[model samples]
Structures are given as C-alpha cells and as structure tokens.
Target: MIQASAGRDRIGRTARLGRLRVTKAGQALSEGVLVAVAVVAGVVVAVVAPAGIAVPAAHGAAAVSLLVRARTVAGRVGLRLTLSAISVAAGGLHYVLVDQMGAARHAAGVFPPVVRVLACVGIAACLGGAVAAMVMAATENGTTLIRLRRLLDGWLIAGSLFTVGWVLLLHRADRGGDGSASFLGLGRVVADILVFGLLVALRFCLPHAQRTATTVAVLALAALAAGDVLRILPSEPGAWDGIPLAAAGSLVGLFLVAVAPWLPGGVSVVGFNQRMMPVIGVVAAFVPVVFCALAIAAHTVAGGPIDTVMSALAGSVLLALGVRQGVIHADHLRITHESVVREDHYRTLVDRTSDVITIVSPDERVLYVSPAALWVYGYRPEDLVGARLPLYTHPDDRETLMQAVQILRQDAESDIRGPGRRVSCRVQGADGSWRHVESTINHHPDGLIFISRDVSERVAQQVQLEHLAFHDALTDLPNRALFADRVAHALRKRTTDEAPPVVLFMDLDGFKEVNDSAGHAAGDTVLRHAARRLRASVRAGDTVARLGGDEFAALLEWEAGAPPSSAKEVAERILTALTQPYPIGTMKAEVSASIGMAVAVPGITSDQLLHQADLAMYAAKAAGKGRIRLHHAEPPHAHRGTPNG
Candidate 1:
C-alpha cells in the first residue's frame, strides 16, 4: 500500500486526509503554479523587462512539489485530475500567449519557441494524467468513477480544441486561406471530438477488457489523423508543430495503456462494473470506435456543422428512446417488486421472531434463515440462503433427524404438525467460520418452519446430566441402577442356543476391619481401589457396577460354557486382582472379595439371579473368606445345619 497521504480525494474530502509520503504527493501543483506564472509573465513581458520572463518557468518548476503534495491528499486518481486540468490550462496558455498574445521573450537560445515547447510538454503530461485518472477511477466507487470518466472525456476534448485553435491562429497569422495547417487542424479536432464521444458510448455499452483495446485503437487513429493534418502544413522557422503534436498524441495513447488497468480495475473503483459485464463489454467497444472514427473523417473533409449537429442529435434520440423503454418496462418492474416484497416480508417474520428460524422447502432448498443465524451459528442470512440446510447436519444424527422431519412433513398432510424432531447441525458463516447449531423443524401450511439454536453448551450440560444419572459421582463407576439394569438385561435374554449369562455378586471381605483399624477416609480409599480392581480385572464386554457401599456386581456374557464355570472363572479374576494391597491415602492395606455367582436359568428374572448370587456369596464367606462358590440344588452339607430365612 502507498503511504496514507499518497492517494486520491476530491476537494470536499481533501481535508479528511491525514499525512502521507512524498511519492504520492506528486500530482497537482505543477499547472496551477504555471497558471499563476503565466498571468505574471504575460503582464511582465508586455511591460519593462521582457527578458526577466524566465521567472514564470522557475515558478512553474517550484510548483511541482506543491502539486504532488496536493495529489497526496486527494490520492493518485484525484491528483492526476488536478494535473490534467493544469496541463490543459498550460496548453491554452501556449495557444493564447506564444501563438496569439506575443507573451514570451524572443532572445538568445531560448526564443519564443520555448513557450510552444512547454505547451507541447503540457499537452503530453495532461494526456498522461487523464489516462492515469481514468484507470484509478475504474477501481473506485461508481459515484467517483462516473464523474472521473466525464472529466477525462472533457480534458481530451480540450486537447483537441487547443490543437485545432492553434492551427487556425497560425493560418490567420500567415495571411493564407492556404488550405493547409488550418484545414488539417480542423479535421484532427473533429476526429478527436468523435473519439471522445465514442469513448463515452463504449464506456456505457462495452466491457472493461474491450474498453482497454478500444481506447488504444481510438487514440491511435486520433494520432494518425493529427499527423495527416499537421503534415500538410508548412512552417517558416523549423519542422512544423503539427507532426510533433501528432507524436504527442501517440505518446498520450501509450500513457493510457500504462494507466488503464489501474483506473476502474484498480483499488479505488469497487463495483464499477460487475466482473462478467467488463469481460463481455470490452469487445463491443471496437465497433463503435470504428464508426466514430469514420464519422470524424467524414466530418473533417466535409467541413460543415452537419457532423457536430448529427452527433448531438443522435445523443438526444438515444435519451428519448431510453425514456420510452423505461415506460414500457414499468409493469414488469411492478411485478418484480411485488414478488420480492411478499417473499421478503415472510422471511422477515421468521428472522425476527425465532431463536433460529429456517424455512426449508420439501425439495431441500434453504428458502430462508433467521437473524438469529448470526448469534446461533456465525452465518449471515445470505450464506445459508439457497445452500442445502441438511448439509450442515451432523452425519451420525442425519438419519434420525431426517426421519423425524419426514414424519412431521407427512403429519402436516393431515394435522400440519407431527412429533417435533431435534437435529444437531453446524452452520457456516459468510466469513467461512462454523458454529454448532440444533434445530427443531415443523411443516408449516405453506412450506416448512425450522427453529434452531446454538446448543453446543447445552449438549455438554446434557452429557453431564446423563453421567450423573447413571454413574457413581466420586468413583465414576456404574451406580446401583445401572448395575441392576445390566444384570436385568443379561437375565432377560431367552438364550435358546447358548448358555445363560453369569452374575458375580461381590462384597469386600476385610472392608469393615480396615475401616475400624484405619480412618474412615482410609476405608473410602479401599472401596475406590477395590472398584478399580474389579473394573480392570473384568473383560471389556463385562459390566462392572458399584452397588452402593462396599458391594459390587459384574455381569459376564457366556460364550460356549455353562454359566457356573464362566461365573466362577470371572469371580476368581476379581478376587486375585483385589488381593494386591491398596495404598489408602497414607497407609497400604490388603483386602479380598467374597464373591457369589449365579449361572442364570433361561427366562429367569434379574431378581432371581441376584437372590441366588447373594445366597452363594454368603456360602463362600462361610467356606473360606475369599474363594467363590456356586449355589447347590438345595444347600451345601456345611450349610444344612443353618435355618431357612
């Protein structure tokens, strides 16, 4: 980026500009300084010291820095403009003072031709400046560009007029109606005027790519025309000025080529033409340029007001035709407005009222999104508009979400509302960022209404809720309800092919003894350590449940064996793992599990399994403390002496 001070601005905005670097400041001061110089030089030359007239040139030289500084405030494009205007004034001074007014001192090597040379140089600079302005304007806003374009055309017209007027003055001075430089100059002037008009027409009609080419071609033809006019004229002192003017014009054309892309296509003029329009419109400019060149050639040779009048009249005709076309399209405009308004109003209600409103059509187009889209998901209404709504839906939840919507849409056929479905999705924003969102969709009488929210936080909260409901808060193991549920599911299976599942009921054998010897805190540690051992000892497919204080249950799926064998095998695994001493906070303590197992009967309830396991567990405790036991048909010989409950 250029220094802040180094860009374009108009008079009104110039004060708004802050400071900028020197290079960007180079555009405006030159000609305005020359203007002040000329007024003084003209008067001074006419008075006492004609030789001292070189002061004006010195002053003009000094003004360059000032102009550049001014341009910096205005920016590159605006600064170019001020330069162009100043150049035009310089060219006019050349015509009036050197050609007509007897302004410059005629002495030494400097001579009066110095003024003419300055004029030629000014014309060249002005043309370069205008081209630069146009290119910068191209990248600017429509409002800024439109005015810049008009100014460019006007500046070009001035160049042509000055060239034509200069020749006419020369003809008058030489006392020859000599059908020479004057007529050639008139032809060039008319041709340049035509070129200017054609440019304006092409600008509106053609695209940017074509405009660039057409601009070059028209400028080339203009140079050739100037050459033809100037070549025919004869001058007294040196080679004629006309040809050099034609050369200046050629250089001007080259300058335009350098500057054109920077105009509307550059940083300034945004939204000047839609991207596609510029691509196509450029090609169309050539045809108009050719016709205009031809008209100028014809106008130049014919030597009448007919060409000028015809061009003006044609512009009027086009204006009138455009007015008529507007009248014809008025009804279409009304219809377009009505359709858009209806849709907009419907969308507006959804945008305002809902936390996240989405109107998804049956066909899958995202017809509308709400204002809450911004808060719920970092997306604007436009980003989702026409994007498929379901594309954002989480893949794992899609089937369930779609199924629910389908059912609702079907219900709408009867009642306009089915059971609502919650779908979790993510929405992408205009900035290409995403946010997690959940939506509840309903089929409205017209189409569909979806209310959505950013539920990422809520989803985390729900996960915590589910965890609390099913697990031990401290040890993070399955609680009694979950443990019972696992056993219940295992027992509920009606296994016709394989063995029934086994349940292992466990009580930490030495837990109370440890609690009495150690602190209550130490006892809690033993309970937690025992749970961990039970969990680690069991297979991944087995369920390890903490059944309140000091008691635990495990459900094991039977593979190819009877339930008693697998139950005994798993109980042994738990007992072995629990024997490893646990470091309870400060002290190490050893413990064992007194486990009872039940190989479930087919179609038996979970409560039956629990009762049998409890009975077996008590028997194991009596038999030896840590070894597992199985339920016998009635009772073991050792337990035969015991009373029935």
Candidate 2:
C-alpha cells in the first residue's frame, strides 16, 4: 500500500514540474515575438519602398501583425482598432494595384471616393478609440476632481503647443487648395494633438505597473503626431508627398500598441508617486504661456504681421491656462482643509488618553510631555520640560532606565531598525510617593519618546499572591516550603569549622483535646500562641514555621565568629514556651509540646535532616508529654521540662 501511494505522489510531482516549465517557456517565447515585431517595424520605417505602393504595403503588413498580436493578448479594444486598420489597408492596397494597372495603359487612375471615406473613418476611429481608452482608465482609477484637474492640465499644454505651431508654421501653408481637402487635413491635425494631450493625462493618473504600458502607447502617439505635423508644412511637392512618412509612423505605432498588453505584469502592480502630479501640472501650464509671451513680444518688436487668427489662438491658449490655474487652486484648498481636520483629530486623541507621553533629548533632559502627565505622574507638562529624566525616577531603578535608553539609541543607530524597548521602573509623583510605571521607549530623530503607564496596583496584587503562596494563613508564619528553602541555603553556606545548622520539629501534646472540649476556635488560638512562643524561643536569624495542623518546626543557623547556641538548649526553650497557657476569649486553655532536635552533619540533605528530626519527635512522644528528645543513633536521651513561661 505504501509503494502504491508513493508512486502516485511521484507522478503528481512530475506533472506539476512539467507544467511550470511549459509556462516559463511560453512567456519567453512571447517576449521574443514582441522584440522581433518591434525590430521589423523599425527597419521598415527606416528603409524606403517603391513610391505608390510603399505606404499601402506598409499599412497592410502592420495591420496583419497588429491583428495577430491583439488576438493573442485577448484584448477586445485592441482587436476592434486593428480590424479598422485592416479595412483601411485593404482599400489603400486595392487603389495602388488599380493605379499600377492603369499606368500600364498610359492612363490616369482616378482616386475613388469610397477609399477616401474608408481612410478618413479608419484614422478617426484609431485616434478616438485611444483617447477614449485613456479617459476611461483615468476615470476608473481616480476621483472625478482629479480627472478634471488632469484634463485641464493636458488641454493647457496641448492648446499652447497648437497655438505655437499655428503662429510659426501651418499658418503660412497654402489655403488655396480644395476646401474639403484642407478641412480634412486640419481635422486630422487637431485629432493628433488632442490624443497626445490625453496621453499626458493618462501617464499622470496610472500606477507604475500600468504606467509601463501607458508610456509605450505615449511614444506611439508621439510618432503619429510628428508625422501629421510634418505633412502640413509648406513644401514644393504636393501634400501627398508626406504619405510615406505618415504611413511609416503608423506602421511603428500599430505594432507598439499591440505589444503594450503583453508587457510584464510587475509594471502594473507597483505604487505611483502622486506627489509629483501638481509640480508637473504647474510646469506644463506655465512654461508654454511664458514662451508664447516671449515669442509674441519678439514678433511685435520685429514688425511682423499679426493676424486675427494669431490673436484668437493666443486668447484660447490664455483661456486654457486660466482654467488650469483655477483647478490647481481648488485642489490646494481641499488638501489644506483635510490636513487641518486630521491634525485636530490626532490632538484630541492625545489630550484624552491616560498614558503619559514624553519626549527627551540626547542630553537626557525632557523636551516635551503631554498633558496626560498631570494625572498620571502628578506633574504638569511645563514642570518636566527641562528636567533630567533620572531625577524623576527612583534611585534604585535609575540605572535600569538609563540602560534601556542606551539600548534604544544603539538600535536607532544600527542599520536594521529595531522595535521599541520596554522597561518597568518606579517614578516619583508630585506628592513624593513612588509609583510603579511600565514605559516603552522609542527612538526618534530628535531624541527619544517615552510612553508610560502606572502599574502600581498590579504590582501590589502580584506581591500579595507571592506572600500567600509560601506562608501559613492562621499564624502568618513561614510554611514548610519556605523553611526548607532557608535550611538548604544555610546548609550550603556552612563551613567545616563552623557550627552545623539544626532542625527542630515539635507537635502539640493537648491540641486535639482543646479542639474537642472548647471547639476548633480555641484550638486555633492555641496554635497561634504556640507559633508566637516558638518564634520568641529561637534567634531572630533562625526560621520558625508551621508544618501543618498542630505541628511546628524551626531552623537554627549560626553566624561566623559569633556566639553559637546549643540545639538542645533551643529545643528545651521551645518546649517550655509551648507549655504556657493561651488566653481564648476571657478563658484560658493550656497546651503542651513535644519537640525533637537534629543537628546537621556532613553531606546530609535537608529532607534527610527533617526525617531524622521527625523520628526524634516520635521518640519524645513515646517518652511522654512536655519532653524534648535528642536524635542520636548511639544513645536515646530525653529532657523532661515543666512550664516556665
């Protein structure tokens, strides 16, 4: 069964790897195809072809290539535009063929109205579709206001260039030609200029990823516009002489537009720099206005003729510039209002928060503190402004706080940015009481920022929990765990020449009798009194603890070069004290104690010493009540004592 499963898994992995390889190979082939198309288009434009058929032949080839590419990319818009180009190319090629056939008979080939109409329609559709696509993309991605601003900027730049072109070049071209032909040529020029302007707007609005495709489309439009402009310039040959240039430009442009959708996907996914849009708009609006003014001034000084057409063109340019400025001013006002509102919202949050925020300089002096400090630290913001941080922190915790600040500084200076440092310390309030505060320190370019919150209540709760874990509830004495810990510590520190530590275990003689006769309340009172007497019997450094119920224990440790007390003497003292009467609510109850004493020896564990003491305690009980027994394997000895306290 395992072999069969493994074979299936291996086959699945092989299939997945094969698919990945095929995908990579397909992408590489597509990129190569685009590069080849671009190179071929470039060569065709640069190399001249036969006069009548060159333009038609170029259009047909370009249209076919564009159609194939657009279909490969599955672009509906691209397909629509390329199909129109195919129709125009077919008409042009048909005319060229017929004209060649007529010239063989030495006859003039009359241009058909149908071919002219197809050419006009094809050009209009291509230019208009491109402009529409840019407008749609911009509107889909940006706000209406932003689109309006971009549109105004585009028109401003395009209108300025159009005015300059008219005043300098096209205005002098012969207007005595066929009126319809002149109008058509003028229409084509205006369309080219308008499409170029829309391209500018599109470039500003799209993100970097999509911008790659937009940039390529912009280059294609620029080429088409250049050819159109050149065709109208005054020349000896007929206007048809510019046909080859326009055709070459169109051939390159169609291929470029087709390759746009196949660009790498990464270009469309990156962020765009929206901040530069305003600067670009300002430059685009002003530079042309200034240049036109200078040119008009020069023309006036030179006594050149300025006609009504020039005046109208200049006025239109000025009008577009005015509208562009208005849009920019409105955008500026909107941004300013938004910034003020955002600032007010953040200010409200800071003022209302409970956490204290402080900014300190590198010299350790506080630079600024938020208003929350008044309640949290009992100091007004102004009072702490110039104060050093260490002065406000508890003396014991000052070094810790300073160390944290140094670590934060190192983190800020390091190449890899580190997270904020958090430290807990005590801070002095205005009332002179120290409060536990947890602070997170972050490095800033100016200095450091400290955000502190009071945690005194939490610390108090934690301390109380720790106390309850290792102390007896009824007597408030150390429990067995705490006593054993101290015994282990003292034993580890003992020297060979010093007195060994002693462990004493005691059990009450009459505790159960009191509980049965006077109830558990009286027994508790007796236990409390016994614990107190046991503490008084031992030295201050020794540990006295309640093991549980009526049982008790004590650890006697001696200091170096000090008077040492005998373990037997301490046990007798405890026995005498425990035999004393305990007052319980206006009555008296008496209890007797039997104590066992064990002296520590070399290599003895705390538990082993405790067990030995326990065994001695049984021996004391066996010797009768109110007796102290010493733990020894050689001889059994007991000290019978009477109540002395």
Candidate 3:
C-alpha cells in the first residue's frame, strides 16, 4: 500500500499510501466481503430479484481471488496497481455488460433466443480471454519484463495522428450527413477506429518484442482497416470485421517468438535443466495447444463456424512439428559419430600393447617391432622394425642366426616353428655395447617372430657362472673352464688348412710368500696386477687365459714373415711385464715367472701342444725358478731354458 510518484508520465505509475491503499488483511476482507456480497446477491436474486443487479453472486468470489493473486504477485512494483486495475476493470466491465443485458438472458426459461445467443457470445469471449491469459503467463515463463533503458514516446504521436484524423473525419461527416447528426458522435467513432489502426501501424513500424511477427501483422491489419474505414460513411460506425483479423494476425506473430505450448515435452524438460532456464518448455507447449483449442471452439460457437481459424492453427502446428523432427535427426547423427570415434580410440590402444610384440614375415625378415625394442636393446622401436635379424646378431654369431631365420622363411609348408627355441648370443646395441641376448623364435606367416631380452646382466651373470666354473672367484682373471674353452677355441680355429701357433704357459714365482706374509688381500692384489701386466704385454689379437693358482697361458700365431724364434720374443715380453715391482699395501714385491713354450706343428693337436708345454715348463722350473723353456719338434727331450739377463 506504499504509493509514490513514479514520474509525471501517466504510463509511469503512482502509488497512494492512505486508506485507499488497502493492506493485505484489508484486501482479503474486501474479497471475502465481495464474495459474501455476491453470494447474498445470488441468493437474494434467487428469492427476490434485484431490479438493478444482474451479473451473478459467483463473480464476486472470483473477483476477490483475482485481486488477491494480482496483489500478491505484484507486491512492490507498480504492477500491483496495473494488475488490480486490469483485473477489476475487466470483472466490473463484465458485471456492467451482463447487468444491462438483463439476468433473464442467462436462463432458458426467460429470455428470447437471440438475446440468449448474444449473452452466450459475451460469456465465451470472457472465458476464452481468461483461459488465454493463463497460457500466456506460463509461456512467458514468469519473464514479465526484460530490463530496458526506457520506453518509446510514440504513443503521443499515435494519439495525435488519431485525433487530427478524427477531427477531419468529423468535419466531413458534418458536411455530408445532416448537421443534426453532429460532429461529436461522428468524431468519437472515427477516433476509436483511427486509434486502433494507428496504434497497430505504429507498433508494427516500430516493433518492440516483435513476437509472432506482431508489428508486421498489425500493420497489415491497419491497412485492411484503413481500406474499410475509407469505404464507410463518417456519420456511421466503421464495420468491425478488421478487429478479429488484426487480432488473429497479432496473436500469430506473438506465437512465433513467444515460447508456446506447441513444442515437445522433452524440449521443456531439458530447458528446465539448463543452468539458467532459457524457456519453460511445459509452459510454452501448453500455450499454443490450448490457444488453438480455444480459438477452434470460439470459431465453432460463432454462427456455424468457419475454416479460417482452423487453417491458421494447422499451419503453425505443422511448422513446429517439422522443426522438432529436424532437431531429433541432428541428435541421432551426433551420437552415431561419437560412438564410432570411441571404438577407434579403443582399437588403437590395444594395438600398441606394452608386451614385447613383433610381427614377422614367414621369411624371417622383421615386419614390425613394438616399442619394447628400447627396453630390450636400447634401440628405438623403429630402428629394428624393418631391419634384418642378422643386423642385431653378433658378427661371430650372425651366420648361424641368419641360417635359422632362413630355414623358417624357406619352409613354405610349415606355419608353426619353435615356441621356446632359445639362442644364446651377442646382440648389437646402439651404444656399441654387446647385448647378451637369448632369443626365442616363432614362425609366422611372412617370417620368424623373435622375441629377445637384453640379457646383458644375465650374460654377465652367466659369464660369472662360467668363471666360477673355471677360475678363482676373488681375482676373476680367468676361470679354469674358460681357460680351457679359449684353448679349445684357438685349437679349433687352426687345422690342416691353418697352422697352429705356439702356446706359452707360465706360473708365478714367489706369489705364495706374498699371500702367507701380507695376507690373502695382498695376494689378490698381486694376482690381479699380474693378470693386467700379462694382458698389456700381449697383442690385441692374442688370447690370454688364466689357470688356477696364479697360472696363465697365451696363444700367438706365426705370420709368414715373423721371426722363427717368435717364442723367444714373447718370453722376453712376459718377463719384462712381470719384472716391474708392485705395491701391495705396506709392501712392494717384484714378481717373475717360470715360463714354458710348446709349438703346435702344422697339423699338431691341442692336447699334444699343452702336454709338451707343461713338460717344458717343469723342466724350466727344475733348471732354475725364474726362467723360460721351449719343448717341441724333437719329442719331449728337445727342451731348452733361458734365464732372464
């Protein structure tokens, strides 16, 4: 009930804060009082009719409910006054019209058929309008207004146009019709028609919220009205047919931009879920459906009805349905595309599994190697993918590795090969370190699939195992087994096609004294140093292998121009390398050797050469501790010894 001056403009509201501005309790009392009044009026009329009152007692209760809703919804904004004014005026207007028409018009018993028909038409329009208001509220989704800087001042212009035009029409009317049919009456009718048409045209030309193409449609309607107005005599009222047409077109335009009940249920459902509700779907949907139904019913109630209203509604329904179907199709296509994309993503992940995987041609050439190549050989997956297996095999082992793959590739009849066939050999690494690998091969369609582990650590372990099998663990010079293996390898490399070289075997002299006095720690130091010196003295191609208990041996080949006494030169080199004093903790010790040399003849076997070498070495030891001897050619007795100078 707080009334304040909004502005001087009449459209701008003013509020009154006195007794006239009713409080809620006061308003509620008014409604209750009005309903009571209406009910009493109905009952009184039922018993003894009022000569003046005709609109029913029931309406009084309805007006109270309408006033309560309007006041509650429009609590502070001057909309409360607006709603109150609109609702009360509407209700009061109904009461006045009904009262003047006579109460008997409502009952079948009293009024003539034409009077009853007229009353029925009025009731239907009022009811239709009320129902339409409800739908309109929902479709607007409570969005009564958007914030605007200001309203246009075009209303004055429209009023002026209407006024000036009416005055002109009135003067004409006075000139044509009798002066008794004065300008006043003529001006009033002309003004009413002109006001409606001008407002329609003006609102159209300056479209605000052009919902349902209202502005354009209103202008079209104004044009039709203008045509009819021109046809009418100024003294008479203009025909009213343009009102319905113009209103229908305005509604149609409003329906297009305004959210209407004509849309699908799902549209409303999702619209409700958006963070901000753009449109209230359920409300929008109800508006148009109910609107069409009401219009159809109203038209049918109009004398025998017509196709015009039905056609407008049917066209709207068809357009809405078409738009709905298009949205559904778009959604379906998007889902299908997404599903295919997900499937492709899943497939790619499976193809690049972490396990060491390779595809090979039946011919044993590598077709593809998985990313696990880096894990096995320190090479990128791509480095080995198309490279031949022989490329990764050790130079000494490549011949055999290639042969194995060739066998698989050549065998067209077999599709399966060894699943657990292990080949132990050196594999090449990108860093030039030898990768000790154990490869297991499987025959595939195009080649053999070889999965290998860079068992370098394992190889070092295996070497350790072999060294433990043959040599002293503490010194790691050469295990006896490995010494034996190297001897055998050297012997195997020589044959009738290649002459065998000399084998020199030497055992350290006085190394036991260092161990017994300085401890095994010093003894180990002496042994390791001795091994290093022996390795340094030999040519890069020579084989130096250790025998247990500070015993060592060497192999040297005799080239075409080499000295016939090459063994003497090797003995000298060994002596010189060993003569250097070594530091073992607090003690320094000079170490020497009792060396034995035995030449394997052009076709002599390794067993014969080693036995002769041993006998010569024993002979040199018997001759003197620090000495060298040769045993070969003339059986076991052709022995010679030379003491270091």
State the C-alpha lDDT per candidate: 0.55, 0.68, 0.50
Ranked by lDDT, the better of candidates 1 and 3 is 1
Question: Over all chains combined, what TM-score does candidate 2 have?
Answer: 0.66
Each candidate structure's TM-score, on Cα atoms with residue i matched to residue i, is: 0.41, 0.66, 0.36
Candidate 2, residue 592: the lDDT equals 88
Candidate 3 is scored at a TM of 0.36
Deviation in Å, model 3, residue 434 alpha carbon: 7.9
lDDT of 3: 0.50
Q: What is the lDDT of residue 406 in candidate 2?
A: 64
Positional deviation of residue 405's Cα in model 3 after best superposition, in angstroms: 8.7
Clash count per candidate: 30, 3, 29
Q: Highest TM-score: which candidate? A: 2
Candidate 3, residue 64: the lDDT equals: 55
What is the C-alpha RMSD, rounded to one decimal, of candidate 1?
Answer: 21.3
Model 2: per-residue lDDT, tens digit, 1-645?
634654574465456556866886897677668756774764465456543555555546655655665565444445443553454355345435433333433333554454446545655655565455445444443444666766666676667667766655555444524333434455456666766766666575555435655666667667656544554554422324544565556555545645654565312321233634646645655676677777777877889777887788788878867776676678778778978999899889888988888899878889989899999888889988999868588888887788777656654554224577788999889999989999999887778999889999999999888888899999999999998898899889999778888899999998898999999888888988888888899888889999999999999987665454577788888888888888999988878888888888777778777877887788888888689877763222333323232
lDDT of 1 by residue, 1-645 (tens): 212322331221333232322222442244234334433443343233322233233224323433543454556545644553454344333333333213233344555455445544544554454454444444444443333433333333333333334434334434433332233234334434444543443354344434443354345335434433443344431233322343333233323322333233212322243322344343343344344445545656878344344555445434433443453255346557867999899768766764877788776678877777776566677888998646566566566566656555555554333356666766554565555677777776556788877666777798899999999876788988888888887666646677777788888888889999997888888888888888898888889888888888888887654554566667787889988898976668888878888777655667667777778778778887787877654322222332232
